[model samples]
Target: MTATGLTPSTQGAPDPASQAAARPTAHHPARAPGRLARSVRRNLTAHGFLIGAVVCFALFSWYPMVREFLLAFQKTERGRTTWVGLDNLTTVVNDPAFWQAWRNTLLFTALALVLGFAVPFVTALVINEFRHGQGYLRLLVYLPVMLPPVASVLLFKYLYDPGYGLLNELLRLLHLPEQQWLQDPDLAMLSVVVAATWMNMGGATLIYLAALQGIPGELYEAAELDGAGLLRKIWHVTIPQTRLILTLMLLMQVIATMQVFVEPFLLTGGAGPEGSTTTVVHLIYQYAFSFNNYGAAAALGLLLLVLLAGFSAAYVRLSRTEEA
Candidate 1:
């Protein structure tokens, strides 16, 4: 009411604090359609890739494996499938031919392991010891791996011809008996083993050579400085250094050789003169294709898968133990 306390114009006007509080807030545009469109596009992009990958794997790998597994319990008669349970497995196990095929596969694996395993390792070491022409030597050793198995098997078949083969001629020149390379029941497996070793050794030879290249030259040099002879250096330094690769190769060779097919299929008429060279794979072929027993073939195939699994498990455990 007093003149000094307040004027009429000030009393009627709005407060400064009230005017500041009445200011407008910020506004951002929310275009629902644009946000929705972007979200859908990104979601579709991610899910499309995921679905495509799964479909590819299912079509190529998973579906075939499932069918094969199911076939183990099924029989196909003129394109009709019927459930047979464990009958196929039992029948296969009871067959004398099954046992013979197993024996041949095992023997072939042994022979192959001997030649396939040792020859490559020894050859790799010899190549590694030299300080020159390693590239050329490696190529030469791996050359056989590039050859088609059919060509090599057929070539060996002629080389193994009974009377006129190069093998017989060489034996005659040395005054040795001209034994049948693939005719006799006892020697048929050996002939297959020889051909297999020749055909397969090249890949392993190069693998061993690569493994050998990783070993330090210093170890061998130190051993030599310590008056170690060639054999001693090899025994001490070389063996231990390349032991892992060697073990892995041996397991792989055993698993692969157990499934021997091409050499016997092409060279020996699928089973040789008798069933002497009939491998497990060849036997499976006989059951599935020749005999038309899909169930039994599946049973044998599943059995082979189990055997290979065992070998693989053992190798993996051994490698883990080595690392530990």
Candidate 2:
């Protein structure tokens, strides 16, 4: 033995741990180039998809918005485009139909809130209360939404016909007055609202029903134990539980109702009797297509965009504040 008490063979041998530490790992250096290439390929693929989406948005959405903004400031005359500054805005504001359209639009929104908003929620509540045939009920409610919008609107048109319409027939059977449904100036807007509600309420009803189903049964049980009736339970338990969804739906409904076009356009020919059902969107359509005033149309659209954006911002802020 040597002075250190080690055999000669052991003294020459290196420790396994030290040899391992000195050795190059299988995953390092040799595999690094392959790993780097794979990483680069993956990153490139992701970037390619992102770029395609950006290009699409730029082409379809952002481009149109920018074009509209530019068009709103410029006027075209005899195929010559000239920057008119706020002249387009002035023209839009000065149009006689401007105030009337705004009024009608506001009226439609209010009426829609009352009917379109309430009807769906009520329908959802009724459907939810039923333990059987819920699926069939939901299907029935959503059937209108599934039909083509034009078909649905045309169906309403036939129903609202002053003569020989099923509704008027039913009224006659009941010995009630057979009134002009769409022809009457006073009833024209209401008729359009009813048509819109029926056409659109299906989706909202389904959403509300889903929200209702998500509410814990224990909460309803608690409400019952507190001697709450149907309305009371809905007010205290249902509304609170689904407040967020309800608010969201309300905002969407308001935005949609404000921009109503197809129903009134198809049903009442855009401007109903005595211009009673003329909406902001209808006015925009008139400016763009009927009058061939692109600048005016863009200006009006810009105003609508601004109004909706401001309203959405306020709603979001208010909701956040309430949550806080």
Candidate 1 deviant stretches above 4 angstroms: 1-57
CA-lDDT, candidates in order: 0.87, 0.95
- In terms of lDDT, the best-performing candidate is 2
Full-model lDDT, candidate 1: 0.87
RMSD of 1: 5.3
Model 2 clash pairs? none
TM-score winner: 2
Give the runs in model 2 whose Cα sits over 4 Å from its true position: 1-48
- Model 1's number of clashes is 0
RMSD of candidate 2 to the truth, in angstroms, is 3.5
Can you give the lDDT of residue 126 in candidate 2? Answer: 94
